[model samples]
Target: MREIQYEEFEEKIIEIRRTSKVTKGGKNLSFRVVAIVGNKNGKVGLGIGKAREVPEAIRKAIADAKKNVIEVPIINGTIPHEVIGRQDASKVLLRPAAPGTGIIAGGTVRAVVELAGIQNILTKALGSTNPLNLAMATINGLKELLDPRKVAKLRDITVEEVYKGVRREGNA
Candidate 1:
């Protein structure tokens, strides 16, 4: 198998927050970052890092993202089918769009699909609008995508049958 390098990925930071811990020695301050990394060729990842400084938090996030990388199948710069992902109270609905439509999404969803190399898509952010939850929900949706060839093999059918929705009676 070919190894994927982090250097090939583009990184985007979605959120940065300053957190405080009340302690006897005054308040301990820290930074939290949410980041996503992608290679724009069917691979992406999301990570969160917390640290005492911004750069450290970002660095940690990038490293964590690299470890959790996922493969996103892109068909003509869009997903092969519609999907919905849920993270806590946040639900993201992803639908493939016609060519030239571009990505119609909000902040977090845009970052994820763009990095995943999807060029045309429509999205709706339902329920909670929290950035962290929304980002996680997007990742979950992408993760649920299955390659058509793989699906055909699993169902003992041809790739054309998978696309045409023609299921073999024996297999069904």
Candidate 2:
């Protein structure tokens, strides 16, 4: 698949926060934003940016997200297998769902999974609720996906042959 252009992808603003720090003279103010970039076609990325203004933070987050994009292995609008991804104190569990199941997830995990073009999935946040960590963990889960074709090649067999005997009417 060809790489998706930055302009062609959709940008979703995940969160924005105003942070303050105590200094010698006064409190320092800054804005932090989490942004997700995607084409809704098996590619997505998450990025965090901090700046003195909200717009600048969002722009920076988008740019960073574009640079960090990853291609997901989409199988019939869902993941190929179940996976649990962990980052720092956060953990995200991902599972493939039947057609029309939609995305079963919360704010952070849902945003990441949806942006990755997964139409049917089940997600659960296992550990931390931190948006940043949760987003990273979700990304990690996608990264771990293995393509069935690649696995078939590695095993010296055709894709359909890999499941031979798993069905009741196999080889009939």
Candidate 3:
């Protein structure tokens, strides 16, 4: 794991929703913010925080996300294979891409992938389009990645052996 500091990570607010509570005193208004924090080095997290104020909610969200940070397997600035993640009704599909393909994702998926330092990849959202669900699903997909070296060790083979015939010139 690389050294991570809160100051070093970039932050983005994915979505914000407001709620009003009915009380004897009148109505209590609160903001719920879906926030993402990433070091752009394969470490990223997603958080949801609710507060009476937006900035406070964002701050809390960032702190909460830091506690839930996860490291993704990044090879050549992309993932090792195609993966899918589901959270509630949301499903996110992620696939590795060539170096120059850039990030091919929408709002929620884009934010999550960008923070994970994934520069070349493709993504598709299925089922739910809700930002919170999508973000969680994206994180879940990243959580499932296994490094090639680790897989090779587990299989009692070398990395090249594990990937034999998988790489070809202009195959990206």
Count of residue pairs whose backbone atoms collide, per candidate: 0, 0, 0
Which candidate leads the pack in lDDT? 1
RMSD of each: 2.2, 4.0, 5.2
The collision pairs in model 1 are none
TM-score of each: 0.92, 0.90, 0.90
* Candidate 1 least-lDDT 10 residues: 1-10
Error of 2 at 84 (Å): 0.5
Best candidate, TM-score: 1
lDDT of 2 by residue, 32-146 (tens): 9999998899999988899999999999999999999998989999998899989999999999999999999999989988888899999999978998889999999999998
What lDDT, from 0 to 1, does candidate 3 have?
0.92
User: Which lDDT tens digits does candidate 3 get at residues 47-78?
Assistant: 98999999999999988898789989999999
Ordered by lDDT, highest first, the candidates read 1, 3, 2
